[model samples]
Target: MTLRLVIFDVDGTLVDSQADILASMEAAFAEIGRPAPARTEVLGVVGLSLPGAIARLAGDESDDRLARMVEAYKTSYARLRHQNGAASSPLYDGIRPLLEALHARDDLLLGIATGKSRRGLEALLDTLDLRRFFVTAQCADDHPSKPHPSMLLTCLAETGIDAGRAVMIGDTSFDIDMARAARIRSVGVTWGYHPAPHLSGADRVVEDTAALGRVLDDLLELAT
Candidate 1:
């Protein structure tokens, strides 16, 4: 099967932005007088939409209070993100080479499915000069979060590619689950936030960006 498209998840799979995210989230929680979860715990919430993630953090709170907490988080995050001397995030090593190799393939198309808002993704893309590589993007703004298959299906609809000809790549079970639910192939990555076993459902897992690129041919083959 000739793979028609590869949809990537932004934060963990493409760039290491967790430090900045964590810092901003922490400040947000602190300002609301709600303690933030530990960094390791926050990692689990990375791929979910804001409401979903906030629900996980707010636990048994009433919906109205949860809404307030979400607003507080937003207010705090808006103020702290990209401020306070936070370091800029960078792409994982070998990403450039990987993208270059894939871009050279005429049969392949690239897209992004992320929990990030469209504005957030555009900011990162513009900063990294990676906006040109993708032909489509399905962000958190448009639909329900991962494991729901909303974004993956949106990508398929946009690109006119069936699930059988697509592959989803990321570092979390959310990615694998979404692809599985959508009946597409999934590739998981190491050197990202998730634990290895979290990606057990992926068709294959790669340890680094170089290995990820090398395995794309095989992954695409299985998709077809």
Candidate 2:
């Protein structure tokens, strides 16, 4: 079989996490006696790693303040996750079916490349019952933030899939840019935090999970 890999972005792609993320960000800012960023500002930094994202939201805050904010954000998010239980950050519509269909295929390998930490990713996968579907998982804990290509490059290496035979599916410019930087094809979804214009750099832009499934099938067929 030709080795083909499909890498997914976690937050805005597979899961609708904006509410949890925004709530936690607000709590984090409150903890430090700082004003909370608006929803648009929070959404803008969704695809980057927590520290980097928090730093951007912090503006001119000192490095120590940024670090404290990051920690507070993590703590707030953890509390939210614990409180939400099974309903935490529900998967987007059609995501489960899409994963099931892809997992059923023999020729394609599945993986995740995200700004989420390994622990955080593991919890998400477990919560969504998605852990068994992925063969390789690369997280911010192991790589530089998105648009740097480290996570995607590591996924390609670990999965033994050449960049030419892989595609990254995501909802943000960071995801598309990361794929581009890694020399792989990228497919963008419109349902993510970023706007469609921001994702124009992607090789293909899709509207929803059903469209996403078709794009994935087409990419693999072309790869083969």
Q: Which candidate has the top score in lDDT?
A: 2
Model 1 misplacement above 4 A: 1-3, 75-87
Give all candidates' CA lDDT scores. 0.82, 0.89
Per-residue lDDT of model 1, residues 10-31, tens digit only: 8889888887778666755665
**Which residue pairs in model 2 clash with each other?**
none
lDDT of 2 by residue, 28-138 (tens): 788779889999899999989999999888889888888888888898888888889657688999999999988898888899999888878888888878999999999
Worst 10-residue lDDT window, candidate 1: 79-88
Instruction: Note each model's CA RMSD in angstroms.
Output: 2.2, 1.0
| Per-residue lDDT value at 82 in model 1 | 48
State the lDDT at 154 in candidate 2.
Answer: 86
